[model samples]
Target: MPDSTAPLLLKGYAWLPDLRRRAHDVPAVPVRLLGKRGTALHGKEAVDFFYDEKHVRRHDAMPGPVLDTLFGRGAVHTLDGEAHRARKALFLDTLKDPARVAALARKAQEEWDRAEADWRGRDRVVLFHESARVLTRAVHDWAGVPLPADEEEATARDLVAMVDGFATVGPRHVRARLARKRQEGRLARLIGELRSAGLPPEPEHATIARAVAAHVDADGRRLDPHTAAVELLNVLRPTVAVSWFLTFSAHALHRWPEHRALLAADERHAWGFAQEVRRFYPFAPFTGGLAATDTEWGGVTIPEGSLVLLDLYGHDHDPDLWPDPYSFDPARFTREGVVIGRDDLVPQGGGDPAAGHRCPGEDITLALLAALVPRLARLPHEVPDQDLSIPLSRVPTLPRSGYVMERVRAEAPAPVG
Candidate 1:
């Protein structure tokens, strides 16, 4: 098989889907990546199959570049089995708890309010950059990480760099590596300082940084300072990364102006709008794991130790699964009493988050989007003439012009509850 590493780089999110299409829409498509045998699977069934720990393992599956740029080494994303579960408990507590999520949402709204006020005076503001800063402040303040006002913008840039540069080789990749090293060092020192000061009286009441500082793994060992720093970035980076979705939300509202009225008028519609933005936009292309054992699915066999990629982008846009999948329609999610299936609409990963490799911050992502995107729609701002075209060839692509806005009306409506 021809190595797909170059094609994947050139084609970005469309690579796997286009490959499967050319192969007559096979359920399992075999290929080579970096001289290693690999298979990519599609559909909701594939999500369940890929997440089954008996069939696949995440340990040692991620590329070194991904570890260095996106998820840090020793981060929860790299763990599996009991160790994964133990580490995941910390995220589940901090990210999944309803009250904690609500608090973060509230903080995000407050930060947006402050930033919107500041934007009014500026001639032009980039929604992507400004929103990142808003989320940076919100996550840090909510997580009890002391980010001084002056450092907030720099931190946001670093967080964005880590995600932006993870998928390519170039100056962007260099920026990502340097950002991770700088942040990991900064956060490791903070973890040490908190440990020396002693843990808070109540663990339940503790901040995320404190909780991570004190958490012990399944093997009865606390994460080392560096690993703890990685974990802290695990929390911080994803929240800031939501700026991508938020910016996409701005793009969506501009392209499809009808949704803005619905999103601004009804809170439920805003939730649906958030879901639609995640689905319609390009974010994660796929997630990979190593085959834990020889496994057969859809009449295809995957040998142990081979690469197994669950097709996230393809599955979400699968026409059979989603009628008119290419269309941007929030109403698909807004149907009365419509409950999203665990395996469906996986703009993130799929399967049960608590027991599997799914992102624990999924709830937080949705909540932050639900809380902030509506406010964005309600804010009176003009979309200036700019290059809003999103390139599909860029992994984690965004609007080329960063969705510039000008002639802003700063007197936005009150934050959504």
Candidate 2:
């Protein structure tokens, strides 16, 4: 079979689904990636199957370029078995707590309030860029990182650059590499300083930085400074990455203004709106790992060490899973008695968060979106004329124009008599 890497680069989010469609929507679509045999899977079953440690393993699964630019070498995403479980515990402890998630959400709201004031004085502001900086400050503050005001914008840009260039080559990819290097070096020094200080007592709130710094891995050893830095970024980077969903949320509100009033009025509706934005947008196209052993999925044998990719974008948009999948509808998530199944939405990934490779930061992502998107809806601004088009060929795509807004009104109108 011909290699699909070039096609994947060219086709972006459409690559896998288009391949499956041509194969008559088979449960397993065979292909080649980076000169390795690969099978792509979709649906809720695929999510469960892909996440099972006995079926697939993440060790050595991520490409080198990705590790260098996106997740960082030795990041939690590259572990498996007990090592993965142990490393994951760090994130689970710091990120998954209800109280902690709420605190982070509150921080984001605070940052949004401050940024809104700055935006009000400007003629036009790109919501995407502004949101990134806002998230940067909120996440850093919550993570216990001392981000000086002067360095905030540069730090946010580096974080955004890492996510932006992870999937591509050339200039963007170069920037991603440089960005990761700069941040990793900076964070590693911070970790070293904490270590040299003999590890001070953590605060009552238990920040992620302190938890990660003090964490001992499955091997019963604290992570080295570089690895510690990577873990730190694992928390910091994804939180900032929420900026993508935030921008997409803005795009959604612009295209469908009907949801704005309800989003502002109902918190639960805002949560549903956040879920829909995650489901509909093209953030992570797919995620992959290597088959742990000889395995059969959909009656097709996947040899040990073969590449396996779970189609995230396709799964969320699958008609069988979501009725009218292409349509932008938040009510599907807002049904009074309905609860989202763990495997139901694979935007970040699937499976038990505490036990598997599913993103532990998923809660934080949802919380930030829920907190900020409603405020975005409630804010008085107009979408300035620009290129609002989202190109599918760009991995981690956004509106070409970054969703510019003008005529800002940050405060609520006086109550009508």
Q: Which stretches of candidate 1 lie over 4 Å from their true place?
A: 412-417
Which sections of candidate 2 miss by over 4 Å? Answer: 200-205, 414-417
Each model's TM-score, in the order given? 0.97, 0.98
Question: lDDT tens digits, residues 1-417, model 1?
Answer: 899999999999999999999989989999799999989999888888899999999999999999999999988888899999999998898889999999999999999999888888989999999999999999999999999878988899999999999999999999999999999999999999999999977655799999999988999998999999999999999999999999999999898888877886799898888888898899999999999998888778899999999999998898887889999989899898877788888988999988998898989999999999878887888887899999989998999999999978855456798
* RMSD list, candidates in order: 2.1, 1.3
Question: What is candidate 2's lDDT per residue for 257-294, written digit by digit as tens?
Answer: 99988986788898899999999988889999999999
Q: Compared to the true structure, candidate 2 yields what TM-score?
A: 0.98
Local distance difference test scores for all models? 0.91, 0.91
